[model samples]
Target: MFEQGDWGSAADWAVAPVDHSRLKHPVQALTAMVLVARQENAAAAQKVFTAVCAYRMGIAEDFDRLGEQAADWLGVGAEMEVALVLGVSVGTARKLISVGVTLDTRLPLVKAAFVAGELDFSRVRTIVDAVDGVSEATVSAVEAAIVDAALQRPPRALANEIARLLIAANPDDAAESRKKREKHSRTVKITPDSHGMAALFATMTAAEGVVVSTRIDEMAATVCRRDPRTPATLRTDAFVALINCETHLACRCETADCPFAHLPAAEPATVHLHVHVDVETLLGFADNPANLEGHGPIDPDLARRFAQDATWQAIVEETRSRCPAKAHPAGFVPTATKLLPPPVPSGIGGAIADIKAAIDADPKVLDGEFPDGHGGLDEPPPGALSYRPRKEVKDKVYAKYSTCTFPNCYVPVRKCQFDHIEPFDHSDPERGGWTIESNGHPACPYHHQAKTDGIFRVVRMAGDAIVWVSRNGAVGITIPEELGGSHEPEARKPVKLTRPAPAEDPPDDAIYDPTWWEQHMQSGDRPPTLADMAQLTDRRLAVIYRELGTHYEEHLAILAARDRHMPPPY
Candidate 1:
């Protein structure tokens, strides 16, 4: 629709209109333009990095010839120069330069992909680091098989795939590699956490680690048999008590052969572990991993070991309505999910009866679970003066946005405070925004403070659409997940237009073409020459990228020659 417009001048462009063709017009074109831009930008970055590699290679090859005296007299060092300019440590600067050089010198297919911009630096680093010290023969074979796959995969996924490929290439080497990796343990590290606590982690053999973790879980359950602390806290304290030889101070489980049975111990406690294992894995006939609740899947062998001490309870997961429905209502205590053999959790009932009563009578909770209007806030009755939202309203509002409405801020909604998008009018409460889901959004304490201090302003649009304007004049939109702008329009908007001027392509010719090495590397036994582009198979041409790592006037010459002889569609 933009094609049929008189949109050359600003005035003409304003008068000329466009048909918002959902299938073909602006949206598709906009998406295509973004992808093209990313590809082009990546190619440009690759070209710069390629030159950086060449410079490093030159310095390395000539450093000895230049002599220490020459280096000092010239008032320069390539290493320090890169370090300062890139703001990286000297070691990092060296590696950055070396990666480019090594990639260009060895993996032609990888280099081609990088140059063409199909694979960005992160993906390139994955390939280079994986093949770093491998023999040239292995490197060549790995590169041939992995570059195309790498371009199609994310960095982490590509690394996993390469591990399988490398193992297949040399099983003996893989065994040795595993043996070397095993040497990395026999150490413990401590990292600080919130709440004035720290995590003390250990690295050990898998079998030993699983046994140790299970022991801690058992000891923790017994120690906290009647205590109200969370299972996680009890487990940590249990581990600490044992390691410090202070089990008597914390543990109170007493049973025959119990480690702390006779030392200020009481009733033995049962521990529950949720493990999912297939029959084949359970029988040692397969290597399929098992799923451990709370943790991710574990090794099949490890899963069986955990199952030995654990009494199995078959749990059929229940999928309920998207609405939490019963998780949090206007009540003080939430009812459990209505599953068969209901899984009632622990700890909540341990609260004092007085505290529960106080919570039940609180103004927020007294507002009742049901909303007065379609899940939105209701106006206060004529006699009522307070405008505070109900527990249900606040809970729904917080859960609606699981994170702070501030763009890129990850503060969880539970940790955030609800703020009125339009400041509540305390003087004339009803005239001001009502304290309801539509008027409220979760903002972390810091952001809430900022909003109060006028550093941020929020506007609630039609249907709870939040528009957050930042101190720096950035506007961010937060749409409720269920009410995203995904619905199709009822009718298309017809637009009148005249001829519009064409947008000029980038000053540099866009590139995603493959050169001779790229062609030769990917073609297997039969390779295509520069003149055989039209004869090039889709598989071959697919790997050939353009406007990437090695692009410049010199590449332009090669590209032009190939295009003139026989053109291949991009």
Candidate 2:
């Protein structure tokens, strides 16, 4: 049997072999050295060994965090933004918050707390607080809900592994409560460094979106044991378990004896902001599927950069380049260019031309051939030279006014129309034919009508200023800064009209061209309109109203018959 003296000496040996020279600080050096000896010590020295081991683990955690801070300074913080959108469904918002919490706990501090036997709600909150951009109020509220939920059940008695894992995986009811409270939680911490600002700015600018975890926590489920059955087994615990499983290969640690021996200190994961934008809202901006340039999958950082990039700015500039802006729904027109322009088309010269040509060439094309009440025109006369169908004009209109052709109307392509520069009735086929691409320019319907009815006129002034002559003759000279000092003449395409052959009764083959219809249908493609929506809704509501009306009539008729059968009152 081992004697007391032998046990005491063994314990002393376990605690006393610490080397101060090997560590930067005396306490840490002492702690690590003792742990090294304790691992080699016998069973008689178990208590001493455990103490040394705990101290050593504590020191290692401190050094690990120090290393993390160093890495952050070096721009190695694996970063991502977590945007909290304003008007999401409760369920989706909770999922996003849960994802945020999961990402928060991925920090070095939280993982270290788990290894050091100090994991709890307080520790988790601390982990959240450490993130640069997260608001303290938000974390505080979320932490409270998480703690309340954790304290409700028996599993709460176990270590925080289960709770932390749930924070990452199953933040359901608790997440909702936290999100509600977060409405009042608007404060965000700012970091002055590279990764910190990059993450914060990217998220804030993509305010309708946020960044989130890109790290796939494959080991978050199986290895994270917080139950009483595996309380003493550190390797079985989630913190250590993740490291042991080669699931996250990049974050795997190689040390054998340390508590964090398997958990590798690695970068943070992140997701994009646009991915979380409301689906219908995103769809509302896409006029044509082909004009949907920034739609679909994108990285949060990349999406913001794209928004602020020169190319996107150029497209916006081009679309709204020459159109007059109408008053907003509140009956106010914006004078500022700060806010992102709405996706509406603006260039109106082409749309005016197209409408006039429809009226002039085939007065019937307005309500007859095109028949969607396209142009306000009367019937075609005998031997009248009718215009090309509206669909033909629409195709060219889309190509010329890729977006809004107006100087400042960047509405989408589908929202715009082709207008004539000179009224089609007045347009000289000899000077520049109606079909000449340059004769018509694209414009939004509002501006199209405004310009066509002579509410506005486009003409050159003394300089490069394009003067807008109002209906009341008050001229507003729009001196475009971009076009300063240039007065270029309008370029017109020379027209060539062929004489028609002596008409016999025109054959159906002479007019109904299959290629023309095919091309027209392909070109006038706009997203579902208010009219389409109204039609569907009307059909649905008609059935409902008809049933209700019939029910009321039957009941009234029965009552009237009963009254007729009853004796008359004195």
Candidate 3:
């Protein structure tokens, strides 16, 4: 494709090929990816933007040749030519050029995202539009807030988030936005239809429209019961009656005071879902952003106010168990069970404490948090376990990885499947892997399906890390988010093994002994120390050589018997 296309310059397609090995250090590798991705797209797009800019410059240069009289037209024809090609207004064309110049000179973060291939020209332009009102100083903070999100989220969502952050940073911006909207709002237009009916339309904010709609619906419901109008007719009449402060002429019947005529304002509903924020942000000590469901990054001060006035509930973590999510409990603060809860008193003091202890003591209660420096986290009990993990296990894996385990994939773990590293077999307990946290991890649905269908083989390594090897010998390693957590699931440094050379001697025709090996390996005792394996290599080699010799002798005997018996049997 590169050879076939007229990309203008071979240097344009001189980008480096993708190397997933670099992805081991995702942050750094992402830069190399940006260079290649940018060049690749630029080559494919024929470097049109640059060519257009050059063409515009050429037009300006032509005007300059006309001498002092053509000075006024120096940039005019260029912009007109750009506007014609881009199919945008001349003012818009100018703004695009200005933004391009600004991106080249300022907005380092935006420029970085652009180079990273996270922000294409369209996404970059969307961001520029979103930060249209931000000052120079705040641009960095705004860019930092949205760059990662813009990489992952849709342009509209990213724009909405940046908008909310802008509003939070300076409430004045919200007023300005409101003014802009109001300037373009409430311009109703009526046009007669072919059937002699007419339609009225007006533009308004989303909330305004929703409130007006809900109020009209409420009034229409009441009007429908008292009047014989259809639901549609009632809704129309209700809307008309609301603004007129009188019954609509179209209504065939009316009750005293006419409910639609005196419609009440829409009442807002309170939702109690989780909103993640750090301690500093929550206490108003920092300007770090807070995420809301529909509206992203509202002011921390506003959030604090909401938390203070709005009744909130938290799930209590017991001294040894996770408590059920109920409203505020006596002598206990509300902490969402989804988050890491603070340690509680280890001993029982009162009836409540006793209940908490009992609940905590329940064997069914799962413990799946990442192990700290201490090696005291709950391990799987000695027995065959179920094939499915508890919710706690899934959540722990998701939180630990934070993102999908697939190579070069950044899908959030919460949106992925919790897959078992080793396939569990309920019917064959000894060979089948257990339903334990150590065996399970989060994979995005696509990657999980790929692994399940044998597109890639996922092998669990020491320390709970996983390695994926494709059919064609491609390998990808996914280590823990951080080193030394939960089984220290980090790749260990390479080690050199020194032992007696295999060429020195081969195993003799000795008989095998399994008793000692069984006691050492399959023993239900403490874990074997490093010294055990290192010191036992001689005996292990003897066992392996013995098996190899015995197999050869058996094969020779079978072949000799077959050779002698073949002629007599024929």
Candidate 4:
């Protein structure tokens, strides 16, 4: 060691800074490799997989380009893989194809326009029904955007891009738009007819603050006059709304004689349950005038006659009793107990077994039509609740936790579950129940367990971003660049509470239009629009002849050809 200078002349060596730029591509490639290796990151792989498979399938250049850009190449590859492995049926093929196409692009938004109600695609749809939407050109443009985004980023990023495209191009039907705009404004008031109408009148406060002193029969007549073919579902639903608005049954007496006597003054006043009715049988009553016991088919003109009766009001105002209501005993069903038949015959496993059997047989025969999973739906699965609450719940979980809540794990929502920051069971019912609102936090199960097992604790700071304090008392706030907005779980970014920045002069290129490259290559060459993406996919599949044997032979031949062409590495 003392003779180092004499032995090595100070060990002169030039340690040049390694050029990391050359390694960037390989790093990205390796990152992608790791991503595709996992089943959860299949969405990213799907884009590339679909594109490559489409090229193999002899798809058109235009569409192959689309597939490549959208990275639907991986998806198509998976489909072929499934078909080859599982011997997928024609119906299954159709379904998978539809889903693949929809998920590969922003097409669901277009198809959603023609359907009534919320933009939910869970209902059944005919193939013909699926095609109903805006013009093809618009949809193609949207898909193009999705494909562009897919090529640039990962699956979640692609979805965000698709969402942005949808917002920019509102593809909703004109009629649907008008209806949506008019929905809250179109108000109607009607009084439901029941024995003892006075009691119902007294409960008017319980109604939706919507009360009309007129009979439902009269209201139905008025609605009929507006639209000749009033559907029964609509009529019944409207009646339910009317009842929700104007009917309340209360008992002043706290004695055992009254059914509601056990409840204190602060207790819930009304217990609402679904009233079931058989439509066909009810309609049968409408067929015969003589079938109406003393009264004709609910004459609208007779509302005045009934409204003047004091006996009806007295009965309506009376207290609840053990005796159920006298209305349509045979036809009416308790609302809650009617629609879904009180869970399955047994537990979840039984229901699942039944579903499996249905799948083996005809699924239609089992669960009726599929309640959700419409032909070309693309929206993410809603979590926990069927309906999202009106106000934004700060601690509410996302449909999925898109990113790793653990400071280290950046796994996305597709592989995530809600994490209760404070263990849910910690809240005693004796004190208060744990609700999904404040107690729930979206996290991958692994990270959630880590948080729960006294390793870490998650807290939402002022900016709504999650901050974690480790058991060792190390404080680390996840920066946005390290992950994405999944940790925040808000629909939009919260307004910055910091003081506004001073206005700066706009750059000369601030409002610059698209360049020639953008106009021709970048923007124009985006994948098909959301509306046209599915149809185009179907059309491509229809023409691409599924020559399984030919494909297999071709694949083998290609492997052989590659063997002949390539030199073996030592």
Candidate 5:
């Protein structure tokens, strides 16, 4: 048995040692370790809450002399400071501060239990959130009722218990709160996941949710029996199709007799999808990964699938000539080269350039916007001399970056605001920043305000990398995704296996037959099973076998099925 000492502070308990040797069995040892870890985590959470409370108190005292407006700004600054130190978003830091304050001021007994390692943070958070917006007396009553169950039950069960207690104490208040949340907090969000996947979250009435789910299942079942997709996959596809306003989810079976083959092709959706892929991968010559804007890297096959319904656009890299001008033939004056726009690269670049050249040649394409060759790629367009960059510059900047340049921020460039790297001077344009690609980057609104407010400083290093330095001397570096450059998958090399030669044959009278053992071991095949060695006198060979006979038989069956043009066994 172990005894917990009465430590003066949470830190003392957090660092207390646990003796694992006291437990004789492995299961007992592991269980004891987990118990000790939980206690340590509870103590650590108590310490964190204590620190938050102390910091807020210090901030309030320091800003007491300042006016209300100044104090409000300092409060926001305090949250930002905490966010930077904790490496969390400012929203999360604000929530932590709120939770910490509530725990310290209202739930004294709960806080005491948390400090003593009797409850974890999840249950504490549940109780704190449940008591919010209720009367002080109601809070006290509910906390007293649920505190014991909260310590004994898991977080989910404890949440249910707290909800019941809250409703019992103040049914009208709870009902009003529920009504307000349902009416105001309904939302739809898409969270990006690893490998270019995303999870969709929607908050709506239970009735509406059930209807949508049933509709998806019905739509999924409409596919023919020959359809290769699983029911879950079919449901997902049907849902996506429904959202895109397609009339039906077509069967994926390639047979000519598919029942849904005669259905008319669905019209393209209005939604725009941005994909960045290399020319080689797009042409199926390589397998480099492609980046779907707002998401991370995706397989080339998926990118090609997206391209099936996409409108193609070429992104050409600009190149400058190094050679000097050549002399024209005698009496044959050449046209001025600079007067004409720079030549586009050849091959696919030239093909796309030809379209642009034809459009430039047409007077209608340049109609009101660029009356005098103002919309060319190399120079700023006319009537755009203001602080805002021209469309060409914005396009180039967006192409250069996939997301906001702020460190660790993943807001898509399409949704971010174009920020001038150097502050533009309205009084003297020539002395300040110019609206060009080199001096422009995208930044989310939050970090943009932080930078403008002097809470952070940003510098553009060589190769278009961004360096962020906080007021407290914290530094972070952000590298550009570079459209197709940074995300390209490196070529994988083939792996070679090196196996050492088998040792000399075992001596006679050994349990196993030396010849039979050497043949299987040296050929990288599995050893004989115990039944196979039954005829022999030795039982030691049983340890060497891995029961690979079933796997080998399955492999042979699969190959035979392939030879007969039959589907492989599951």
Candidate 6:
């Protein structure tokens, strides 16, 4: 029975009243907030769906009056209007309209549940999508079967349940639909991300994906344990190596004793990865960022590494003004100088010329196209090594510890050195301390040195946890990884750490304190108005807007019905 104005102020609609002091745990507070937020979000979405339905109904009236010719134009205009208001793409708006219509027309129960906050948007979208091409008779049954589970399950689980029920309802149609999707929907796409990285997305049959993943894992595992790359990173490198037709990942340990170190480098792939860098940065004179093809700007250091094996090409920028010449009476040369390719361009001047050539090429080259055959674009340079640990010992240590053993340190175990807890008897092997799994712990170089220099002390404790005592007497504890147990003797009377008390909750005024907003405005920023705040709170203004749209749609329908009944003027 809420009226248009009953929703109150934008702040009232947006902020939920949660007594944080009443919640015993942070998790309880968070859970309460999430539930309230979901309810508000659902309410907002229901308003949007209501508005969209009404808008489309009014448009339908125009379509009927103006005939079928105006359908496309009206539809495009409608999508654009929604897109502008939502600040989303036309395609997204179209999808939203379609989902809204589906929810309004077919799945009334789902819509009710959605507005009541029992089902989230993703679950509703999943149900709507699953029933898209389904026969009307079967879809209702599918909706009824899954709506209860959809309330409790995640979107993915809900999708699976929906799929299972769909197949059960009509197995033949489901099989045919899946077959059509597999034939037409398989695609490989690369999307650019921030920080000079790109995500490669591929939609293929599950079997094909499994095959690719297994092959990558196999190739990644071929490297010795001393390789510094994490399993995930190694897998990625292995996938790239497979694309380049290489057998295995090159061990990055870089030690002369490494099994893969002495192996000859694999021949470069025909596909070249182009990098655009400035002349100064290429020559190591500057540290400016360089753009990798497809990917965005990468560190200059990474660019230099790419340059080591890259083929050189020079492209000099030309000026409109002609150079001076002794042959001409005008004392200038009309033709520009044609510079030849430098020999041994791997050196300083040659490297600079190479970079200039790369920069001058078509910007489309960034899309990973280079007709010229060049190799080693994807291969990373070998890292310098200090010491090497036994492969078995390193493997055991890595399996036991996923990250560095130093307190509060999260450096991946692959990137850490296996340090001997009790200094190894290098001079005499049988003199007690040995390079065994019981005595080894992974530590990053910095902390490894500190431990070796007595700046920090770590001792094995009861329950396979390591106690770290710092120089300042601040103590920290590290529990062993889940995969393995330690055989080392435990220390006596280990200190028991106490959990710190939670901080006092902030005063209610802090939620929408005007002091911070005033300060922001004082700093020459544009202060947001109520309308803007309402939009920021996910269309809280829709409370009033939905009411207006409903009345507008009703008026349009009445006009349409009256006009249809009226005699045409001849």
The candidate that wins on lDDT is 5
Quote the positional error of residue 226 for candidate 5 in Å: 7.0
RMSD in Å for model 2: 31.0
Query: Distance from true position, residue 312, model 4, in Å?
Result: 28
TM-score result, candidate 1: 0.31
Worst 10 residues of 4 by lDDT: 312-321
lDDT of 5 by residue, 86-105 (tens): 66666667777777788788
Against the unseen true structure, what C-alpha lDDT does each candidate score? 0.52, 0.35, 0.51, 0.35, 0.60, 0.57
Q: Residue 176 of model 4: what lDDT?
A: 46
lDDT of each residue in 76-185, candidate 3, tens digit only: 44443444444454456566665565665556777666655556766677777766645666666566877777777787787788788777877776567667766754
Clashes of 2: 38
Query: Looking at candidate 6, what is the lDDT of residue 231?
Result: 84
Candidate 5: residue 177 lDDT (0-100): 67
Give a tens-digit lDDT track for model 6, residues 1-570.
112456666676555577777999888988998888687758766756865864576477547655676554454445534554454544566778888888888988888887777777778888887777677767787777779879788888888888899899998777777787788878997655676677889989879999999998898987899999888899899989998889877688878888777666777786554555655456444566665644445787787676666653333322112242112111112332333433331222332233224323532221121111111122211210213456765665555444676544546666788776656555554342445444567888866765675545655433334544443333444554331122222212222223223335432332232332233224444423222222322333433333333333333334433444444461
TM-score versus the correct structure, for each prediction: 0.31, 0.20, 0.28, 0.18, 0.63, 0.46
Distance (Å) between predicted and true CA of 143, model 3? 41
- RMSD of every candidate to native, in Å, equals 32.3, 31.0, 27.2, 36.8, 24.7, 35.7
The digit string of per-residue lDDT tens for model 1 on 1-570 reads: 012345465465232233345437666778766566557646555644754754554455335555553443221234433443344443555666766777768988877776766767777787777765556776676677798678679899998888788888977765665565568535786543443234677867667789989878766766435455677778777787667655333543334555544556333445565566544355444465465543334666677676656766432211121222221111122222222431232221232222224333442321222212212334353322345666666755664454667654556566788787666678976666567555678888766765675545666543344555533333444544322122111111212222223334432332335543344334333332222322223532323321121222234445544444443352
Q: Which candidate's TM-score is highest? A: 5
Give the Å shift of residue 543 in candidate 5.
57
Candidate 2 local lDDT, residue 450: 48
Q: Ten-residue segment with the worst summed lDDT in candidate 2?
A: 75-84
Off by more than 4 A, model 1: 1-30, 33-37, 40-51, 54-80, 175-570
In Å, residue 43's CA in model 4 sits off its true spot by 8.8
- lDDT of model 4 at residue 250? 30
Cand. 3 TM to true fold: 0.28
